[model samples]
Target: MRGVWYRRSAGRVQAGAVLVLAGGLLAGCATAPPRNPNNLCSIFQEKRSWYHAAMRQEAKWHIPVSVPMAMMNQESSFRANARTRRTYILWIIPWGHISTAYGYAQAKDEIWHDYQRQTGAGGSRTDYADALNFMNWYITNSRKVDGIPVTDATRQYLAYHEGWTGYRRRTYASKGWLVTVARKVGHRAQQYQQQYDACKDRLKGGWWENFWDWLF
Candidate 1:
């Protein structure tokens, strides 16, 4: 009888361990964002909070959602911890990166700090909410200072890469590569807008949405 009881207890312990492992795996799947985050639908599907955040930014800044999403895709490929390549001297020196730009929007140090202070967002660059908001703020400022249309991704991106003063001086014309890149960003924004339109209603409800609602 003692041997039978011992075996039953061991079986129960093993079952509990299996349950724990399965629970952990489910948690991981719940928390992990999608890979290859280039597609707008995939991105929103991976984390629905991003969709809400984009909507919030557009409403707050009067900028289109596609604009910031495309610009961020260009700047960081949507990498949460992206950084600029390090400079090298004589092809061997171990110099640090050219700028302090990092995270999704790749915002530089001073501008990022100014954004934080002005907006009181206080979120890190890795946070999509913060990055999108920063992009909207920058683009809105570009519209105001440089007269670049909010919908004009090319000039707005040019002014984004170049400062407002440099854009006013037509600095982007000197850089053909930047001009090409800006045009591509503009096109991507149009694509994202189309993709978002297709899948928006279906993406309305989920655990992430519930969590965000509870959070906010």
Candidate 2:
């Protein structure tokens, strides 16, 4: 009886270990690039459209299409209606403030305020259009007054999550899960770009199809 029990326990442990390893592998696979670029733009367009329209206001700024998309990818996995645990719960309050963030872009109250002041344009923060417009303001401000040369969107994304004050490569720490999320999003951003470029000029949807067609 004892031998039988011991053998059963060992089998359970081995099975559990295998399950854990399998789970990790599956998670990695979702973020991994597909063998083909089929519907890559379709996956990205919702997020890209938001940023592309936002960036259009600043014709000279050349906000890289990859930057905002990466941020959106990281911050919310392109789910415009996504929500974090804290947003729905009063889990833990910080020293100074209570919960004040919401939306596809994860705009906190403080950050949203900065957006309003910078652009003098108003829209609901939870709305995707507003999120794009808000980021548009942030990128323009960062590039112009801050003199942050718009070289790579990934680094700019890090700074966006971290902050411009200590944006230097050495000083930056991704803060909590931002590192994990950014790594995945950053890689996906690069993947999306390559896939989009590969499908160059055969743009998926524009005037060719109405916005409603893109929805469902």
Candidate 3:
């Protein structure tokens, strides 16, 4: 009877441990990328929290919602745990990543640290809200430092990819590919703006409406 009781207790403990481990793994896993990334309205409809976060950032930073949203799509395609591709060793084995840029915005470690220090906000890069906030904050500062307008997604993306100093020095002129990519980002921003204008009314509401939606 004692041996049977001990075995039962041990089995229960093992099962509890397994459950805890599974919970931890689930917590650490990245959220799956949105299904329809091309359409800004579809993306927002699928992820309502993302719309709220983007609106909050836009309200706080005065950067247009379309600009950072387009840039983020180019950077990470809305993947929460996105990182730079790894470099290969001898064209076979995987080595270190191209840079320390990580999470939804592809923000580098040094620049991300600077953002935290300057803003006095604590947040994780893997979090969508934090990433959107960081991107808008960087764009707002870019406007201040580089004289680039908030709505000019092209120059804003150029300044974002190249540091402000690099942008000031016109380094993007040497990189034709980057220049093209920036133009693409700009085009996407325009598309997002058009789409958002059509559906923004539905997204906006008073606190009670928002609360009701949350409950449902």
lDDT of 2 at 172: 51
Score candidate 1 by lDDT: 0.84
TM-score of each: 0.79, 0.59, 0.82
Residue-wise C-alpha lDDT for candidate 3, range 124-143, written one tens digit per residue: 99999899989998888898
Looking at candidate 1, what is the lDDT of residue 51?
A: 74
Model 1 TM-score relative to the real fold: 0.79
Q: Order the numbered candidates by TM-score, best leading.
A: 3, 1, 2
**Looking at candidate 2, what is the lDDT of residue 61?**
44
**21: Cα error in model 2, Å:** 44
Model 2 agreement with the true structure over 1-216: per-residue lDDT tens digits: 999999999999999999999999975553343233333555444334442453353353466555565676566654555555533236555344344556767777888887788668788765666776676667666676456545455555666766666565534564656666656656766776786677546554476453644452
Off by over 4 Å in 1: 1-36, 89-91, 95-97, 206-215
Error of 2 at 53 (Å): 3.5
> Which ranges in model 3 have alpha carbons more than 4 Å from their true place?
1-30, 93-97, 205-209, 212-216
lDDT of each: 0.84, 0.60, 0.89
Cα lDDT over the full model 3: 0.89
